[model samples]
Target chain A: MQIYLPIADVSVNWLLLLAMGGGVGFISGLFGVGGGFVMTPLLIFIGIPTAIAVATQAAQIAASSMTGSIGYWRRRAVDMRLGLVLAGGGLIGTVLGVWFFNVMRRLGQLDVIIAIAYVVLFGIIGGLMLFESLRAMWLKRKGIRRPARRSGEHPWYLGLPLKMRFHQSKLYGSVIPLALLALLIAFVGAVLGIGGGFIAVPALIYLFRIPAAVVVGTSLFQILLTMVAATIMHATSNHSVDLVLALLLIVGGVMGAQFGAIAGRNLRGDAFRLLLALLILAVGIRFAGDIVLKPEETFSLVTLDN
Target chain B: MKRSALALLICLASMATATAETLVTSLSTYRVAINSNYTGASLILFGSIERDARTAPRAGPYDLVVTVRGPRRTALVREKEPLGPLWITRGQRRFVDQPVYLAVVSSRAIDDIAAAPMRERLKLGLEAEFASPLPGPNLMGEDFVEAFIRLRRQQGLFQEDPEGVVFLTQNLFRAKIDLPAIAPTGLYEVETILLSDGVPLSRQSTNFEVEKTGFEQATVVLARDHGFIYGLIAAASALVLGWLATVVFRRE
Candidate 1:
């Protein structure tokens, strides 16, 4: 089961890689969000170089989202126009992200930077999700329905030039803010090796007011495109993608997602979010401990490329 | 003074006669083929002390020192300092053109083999290996070099075994060295020195290469040479796997 990764120049248990992929895939499928965020950290923990872990995780995200977007496409739920605009901005973001990644790597700061990004991102996202889900569950137990929102009051945000209408999502919005948000999401996604599904879905729903039905589909579509671009960029720029690692992860991920989807239907949305929030926070806290705690060995060595 | 000079001359003559012997050695495998299942390689270096019939026999039992030096590379060692809530790499030192992996296996403890000054001059062991010229000294002590050795040793890159070389007979000896799974791929130098009574009589050098073969080699070549295309293929395969998932496990 020991498989050597040519690009990373390391041998790891193939079964462990498969199980990790499967575990991450199950979480993503159960929650309908990306598992990429968790994978990079786990890969690094298991002794894969940070660059390889970050670059290779992008491939797994692309694979997972491909199935999702395709399914959504068949159901005619995806907003192709919006997805294209987001992906266009995503392409630019990915290039810039990869360049920055290269610079940080050369500086020998890639590991610390990645660790910081994961900790901060997971903390904020997980904390918010945990609070929101708990509050909703509490309100439901009290038999108090949330008040309805006033729809027409939020036109100030979408007020930008060059307005376009997305027929599938049934929204009129400026391409600027939406594209800019996609650019931001894609930038962090590429650097952190996440699909940015959770980030995009929330921003789409709250900021752009894109329908829940179309948001998941459109986000997955955009993610699929962006991740594909990210993977290609990482390969050309860093040459850190391990083909053996990627293949094993992809195989296990897809299989796990299938089972996870079936299991997800048995749980309520509130409970699922709470569980996911805990998982996210656990990963965040795990990293925070390493950062704050004194290392057993103060000095570490890395081989530099000629 | 006359008597001392006479004894020194006789000692030189005996040393010259002892140096007539030759050390001949060869590795079990000159080229290590790394495949998918490559964890590590265990290699045996078999050799003998070939002495001429005309020469007097060695006064004492012979000694052997085998040194295996892996490919050379630059390494950056960083020490972390706490900055508020986070620990960040604060100070760093660079070592250029040092062997990434090193293993010294001797018939006896390296210290017992020769005196310190002689060992240092010959560069015979791990201590002498790191004593080579380093870059500009840092504000911090020589702790970085020690730390580097410890780190590499933990990763199985650096090693020392006092009794690794076993002599099968009066003239035949063999040393075993195991290259861990994380061994760097490149030419590795193997050196064997034959010594007796604190005097080195003969030395031999050989080399072997660790190479990734077949699928491993192909992948490295593809990624290095055809980056863009390989990326496309990587991306395409993911998409295919994703599509296949939906097909095989269709949501009702």
Candidate 2:
């Protein structure tokens, strides 16, 4: 069945949209990451205008992450103080990002910018994930054991002013790095139409040395806020958020995430990471090919609302 | 000289009577409601020609051309240049206030209907419709206009059918106009023109509205009129859906 999207001004297949949401939701639940990195590109591939796809996906991300964050909250795994500090920075970054988004759109270069951003961001993240997971598996098979990490050791940067203790993560770190990291993620998320949870989870793990459980919850929390900001910005400024499209996606996504959570219980961590890495790399390669390959039509047209 | 002038006057009088005609046209529907199930719509523009019949029965055949034009909007056309490894947008041309959707139906090929200037004046074909250029970026010649037309056609926003208009009888005729699934909702103008001996005898135009109705209309109004509230409702609904799903599935 086909349904007309109000703001996007296009009719799309409802089944295809539902399936895309389900697929992304499954990945989000399986990995404990918001699937904006996957959903945004897929939506564009299916012919949703890039601007509408980005804005509408932001709302979907917020919805998908809400339940996950709540589950973590019940387990007391969320670092609320840390999440709030990061969200503070995120809110500021979102303003700047949306401004830049409008500028590129007006110049008729939004598609190229989105494509390049996807190629670079996903390429690096996927490559690192593959390398790290492979190394971990290799080390596990070997007889030699790696040195245990020292939790108390603080990097010189963590010794900076405005230090705060995240009681749940059991670490004392300066807010400067955490805020800066959040700001960067929010800026990228606004422009690229993603929740940036995938980037945040790794950053918190490797850079801040936050515990795995806390990182997921904290990342989700920050993601929820960042996406809310994005949705509001796109709705008011660009008026590109399509609520009908969002509702259809959320229906499949909500259910799929539940099933994915159950399925994730049976999967191994390193193997799961490897699979996700491949998926990310595949999407990145597809985007890269779009730029390098000759286009079917060298000329493109868009109707501007008078 | 007097005899020649009188002969010319007699010929002109006969031609005027032969060209005297009346056109009657109506759409299948006056209002097109874009409901949820609306993929597209096909409307038949049926019409008839009433000739003076007082003149010597014109030996030539009659022709009909129908054109449907949707709301006009500005469009941007951009051409990409291969810049080393990747293609980059090199230049752009803007068409100001051009019909967003245009469909033309004719009994015969438009070019065969009349001379080039006449066809252009009547806007009988896509090329003729672009006679006036809106002032913007350097006019990149016919290539850009052709590109615009081709892109719109591919998107189902523009269409043409030479044989769409068919004559059921000598004076009665009908044409079919297919609005694609992606057609924009707005007021559309449908025009039918009668041609006799390569000269326009009569013309008629009617207006119809294609507006979203029911759920579709409500959503659009909410988003455009109350965007902030709409955003809040969207976010709140998502939160509720997520919470509900989690609670229901927790038992499993």
Candidate 3:
């Protein structure tokens, strides 16, 4: 059935929307990823206006992150101090990101920004994951034993000014760098309409050398706050958040996320990483292809409501 | 001079004797309520010519042309240029006060029915209706306008059907205009004209409104006007849904 979306001022098939939500949710659950990278692009492909798609996706991400973080909280996996610091930076970043988003939208350059951002981000993340997983697989095939090493010692940049203690993650680092990293991720999430968990997870693991167990939980916690901030900002400033669209996606997304978490347990780390890397690369390639290939119709028109 | 005066008097007498017929038209409904299931809508525009025997022969039979135009809106039309193997939007033209939707229907081909200048004066064809002001005297502005029209037509927002209007009798006629599912909600101006011998004998104009009703309207108002409450509701519902998902699926 066709449903009218108010903010987007468009009609779309309800079943298609649900399927999109479920598919993206499945990937999110399986990879422990926020799935914004997949969902935002899919929404645009399905004919939702870019502004509404970007703004509305924030609500869905907030929902999914809330569930994920709660689960981690019950298990005592979250580092409250670290999560709070990240959220503090995320709040500031979200404000700036929303401002930038509005500016680009007014100038009619938001679509290009989204396209370029996705291409660059996915290219980097997917390339790294692919190489890392492939190397690990090759090493396993060689049957070479490697010595166990500690993670926190490397990345000497962690010794920068303003050292702060994160007792739960068992790390001493400068709040400045961590805050800056959170700010960057939150800005990306706000502009891209994601939860920023994917970027944050890697940053925590590699940059700060946080324990894997704490990283996921802490990132989820921060993502929840970031998305909430985004939802409010988009609603109040841009009035682009479509509540009905968000609700519909959430219905299928919640159910799919549950099943994804269950299925994720059976997969090995390297294999899972390989699959996720492939998924990211595929989306990145599709976006890049749009830039390289001739568009079917170059001219697009939107009616100004005001 | 005496002969010319006598001829002019004869002509004036004949002109006074001959009269043109007037068209009376009305839409089936003036208001369209768009609900959740409203994919599209079609409106029947039926009209009649108030004809007299002397007027009919003098004015000839009337031909009908109907046009419906949606609210004026500004549009940005962009063209992509290849930038190092990647296509990007390098140039754009802004069109101001352009109709979002336009549908034209006639008894036959517009060109066949009326001369080009006449049609342009009447604003009966797509080109006539979309003759919006350009940004400046740029050479490429015409291309951009054409592109805008082409895209709108492709989306089915702009339509023209030469055979859409049907005449039931010498005096009565009806036409149907289809508004696509993506039709904008606003004031629509519908104009119907009666043409006799390529001259407009009579013209009538009416207006209708397409509005979001029921759940669709409510949500739009909430989002646009009461945005803070709407945002809170959105965040709260997402939180609840998330919590529910975790509780329901925790076992596995």
Candidate 4:
């Protein structure tokens, strides 16, 4: 079928669209990223409406993450109990987040909100990730012994109520904390149109002290569920999901993810973290730059009223 | 007889003077084709200036404006940037194979030091040059090949550079299109307009048909039958190839 874009006097080519989807999918797979960072902006650059881009990206994330999560699960990397608890909270958070997302949309303040979130969160998260990766590299160069165990007692996280043991992570932690973290992450994910893996992975590693070996798997599991919920919510409430666009990206992403998983196995811990950190930092910087600098032209569909 | 001849000469002179001050030319109408991959497309406008002397044909410093509209009668793109002797690339790429209407308007006030009345009566004719079918760089290799193949199979279809076509020195214009072999047969129209001093003066439109035959019908049927399964297999193969290529190329 011929699809025409009157504004650009251009027609859509299905083959080209599929190729683009595949390319983005490959990147996501290799990098273990949600691909939303690149996909959303690229869509905007290519003249897609922003809301459509975000919704379609969410669906794509759901499909691509399913493969990753399944792969990780097969490898005995997923902690189902932990993933489920976190996902339960994530569902609530995502629901709330959808409302908040719509509220911001209605207020015509999405761009400002997105800009601020990118600058603030990206600065903090990217900086921390960078610093940690760099420090790990420095220690390795100095031939310092790696810290494999904690000498002190379990921290305050262990002291909270409703503590439960995560067999895979081998830690006893309060379920409340896990739930709260999931909710917070999901809320951010919904608002930012991301899968929340970036926040969740870091939170699991630093806050909960989940072993690095299991962190990514556990995070993917949670991301998988959260994205699924987000997709359904957006589809039902906002009627925003563009299945055609989502499918195109997913087809490419699945292939990319397969390759990424293969490559990731070969990288050392420091190298992996450094690469991931740099990627995050790069995305953050680009996003921040767009917001801080005055655009040559600015147009929006939303009017300045809630 | 002498008086009548003088009167006739006087009338012709006045008409020539009026035509010399503002000239409108017809440019070729563009038939847009959209690539199905993109969600939409927009148009971009640009032009340059030229200068000239009296009785020497007008030269340089031409002020040109361009606007595009869709078949549904909505404004697609517009530009008003002014520059002298400029080659402007409107930072807009449309989806492939979709038909869109274009309207280009150009106006320039010639600086004449001659008598004020003479200048007022002096007329200028405006001409437009259409950019021919040139392959856009961004068109992926695969899409280009497909479009090229389709174009080759269509009878009575004039093959222009897959890049684009450029028509120079005519103002109001239109395109008569003949669809390709693989193309779904339909009516396509292109409209063009020329304006002087913000006033609409000349307008033209062209219509074309895409006729389908047995071969085209068979190709469509075959494509429909196995397109999904074929796409899946192709994608899988591409992934494997891409992976292998990356590994080989980046071996360390």
lDDT of candidate 2 over B1-252, digit per residue (tens): 999999999999888867578788888998888877677888999898887656445557988889999998889999888889887788898988888989989999888888899988898888789866646665556789889999999998888899999999998999998998777889899989888677887889997888998888998888888888888888888788878777877753
Local accuracy by lDDT, each model: 0.89, 0.86, 0.86, 0.55
> Using lDDT as the measure, which candidate wins?
1
Across B112-215, the per-residue lDDT of candidate 4 in tens digits comes to 22223332332111111112233344533343333332322332122222112122333222222223322333454433333343333333344433333343
Q: Give the candidate number with the greatest DockQ.
A: 1
Expressed as tens digits, the lDDT of each residue in A72-149 for candidate 4 is: 776789988999989999999999988987787655455556656766777788789889989989998999977777
For model 3, how does the per-residue alpha-carbon lDDT over B23-87 read when each residue is reduced to its tens digit?
78989999999988778899999999886666747435567889999988888788887788777
Candidate 1: regions farther than 4 A off: B1-19, B136-140
- Provide the lDDT at B120 for model 2: 85
Q: What's the DockQ for every one of the candidates? A: 0.74, 0.67, 0.66, 0.04
Worst 10 residues of 3 chain A by lDDT: A145-154
Query: Could you tell me the lDDT of residue A140 within candidate 1?
Result: 99
Return whichever of 3 and 4 wins on TM-score.
Answer: 3
Q: Chain A only: TM-score of every candidate? A: 0.97, 0.97, 0.96, 0.89
lDDT of 3 at A247: 89
lDDT of 1 by residue, A1-306 (tens): 898888888889999999998988888888888798778888988999889988998999999999999889999889999999999988888988898899988887777887787789889989998999999999999999998766776566577887898898878868888888889888888888889998889889878778899999999999999999999999998898888899999888888887788889999989998998898899888888888899998898999766
